[model samples]
Target: MSRTTVLPVTRRATIVGAAVVLAVVALSGCAGTSGSAPEARQSPSKSQSSQSSQSSSPSSAERTPAPTKTTDAAAAATDLTFEDGAALSASTLPAFGLEVSALDGWEQTGEDSSVGSREYTKSDGSVATITQQRITDLDPSMGDRAATEQLFTAAGMPAEQLEEQLLPTMTGGTAQFLSIAGHTTDGSWSATVARAFAKPGAALIVKVQTPSQETLRPDLHDILVHAQVVLT
Candidate 1:
């Protein structure tokens, strides 16, 4: 005779036993919708491109005369898919004028412009979201990180759960990837790796909730090595 035991999964259990998924319901586009709709094609339709351009492209008054430091590149590329082992750096971060890359076996799961942030999944089901926010109310007196914490508060990250870390200035000519982990005021758990640029008033943020920091380190390392940002 053989006997087996199964334990129920609890919230705390998930922090270590399973991959983490922290859905940001209050923040629009933080967690994009996932329907039975077929996966997005590598090549977006021309109409879709035109529509996206019309909607997101800034007007003459809004357009920057020149790209800022963190700006990835002037032109956008196609089929720039991010996979587990590969690295990417392109004009992909239009909002924050930056670029981001992560190592590990992760595949993007969903992205809806109206919803904002893109989502990704790991082999173990760990999930992460990438999004950007441009800010203008920065106070240099507070310094880069303190100013960033203020922005974090406004974006809905609670104070208690915040764990801030300093990012390096470069990675063989790439901007450094830094992170913060925290829970929302409402108690939802999340962690985001962010890079802030003061010159142009924008911050590129990537928040992921995994079983633990250990689990996401590899990907974060990849991001740090390849991430690029030019705030001004």
Candidate 2:
């Protein structure tokens, strides 16, 4: 297994949103191409001033390679391996929509059960996604909920800020605060897993310009609801 640590790359706020900027680091682990260095390829942090003459265009200069249709050899080489919702079993899920794929240039690392990162290409290859998975041995319970809450509370900021930035950009479907039967938030679009049967669970989040209301709600709902403890 490849042990890859993604360091988020800060970028110009004028060109990219905070979500997209942070996403550059988060996704690098998931979508790196063959032999690409996830960290090496990243541009300087957003706080660092770049030469004004440097390529100011985000699309041309800061873009990562998009995941296109892979060849048989390429697809076989990609490291996407899931066993019928191994991370989050489909059986334990509520009705929702979801889409996933095995992508190339992804590598496994020494992170508990397994840890892998890869990128997804969508929107005619204009948009890219990086995904990371880490299997662990911690189950949710009354006693552990406190610790879990703490983790979520810390991680939730970026998620919420990203969602808030995205909401306005989102059009079409109704945008409402997600109030699950057993969970709550301080009003944000990011999904935080509230409970699960399995010890360590899986989580998948996509950073794209807010999609249509209908598409955004169902896509996120499915991913969140299906998030369960499956990997042993």
Global lDDT scores for all candidate models: 0.38, 0.23
State the lDDT of candidate 2 residue by residue for 1-232, as single tens digits: 4232331221111111121222111211111222221111112322321332144423322332323542222112111111111232322211112123122322222122122223333332212232333224333332222322333334432333221101100011111111111111321222222221222242322332223322333333222222211111
Question: What TM-score number comes out for model 1?
Answer: 0.43
Candidate 1 weakest ten by summed lDDT: 8-17
Highest TM-score among the candidates is held by which one?
1
State the lDDT at 159 in candidate 1: 36
Q: Who wins the lDDT comparison?
A: 1
RMSD of each: 18.0, 19.8
lDDT of 1 by residue, 1-232 (tens): 3222111111110001111233232221122212321121112233654565568644545444434443333222111211100222322232322232323467768763433456667785467665555454544344444545555555554434444332322211123223344333433444565544343344556666555445444444433332233222
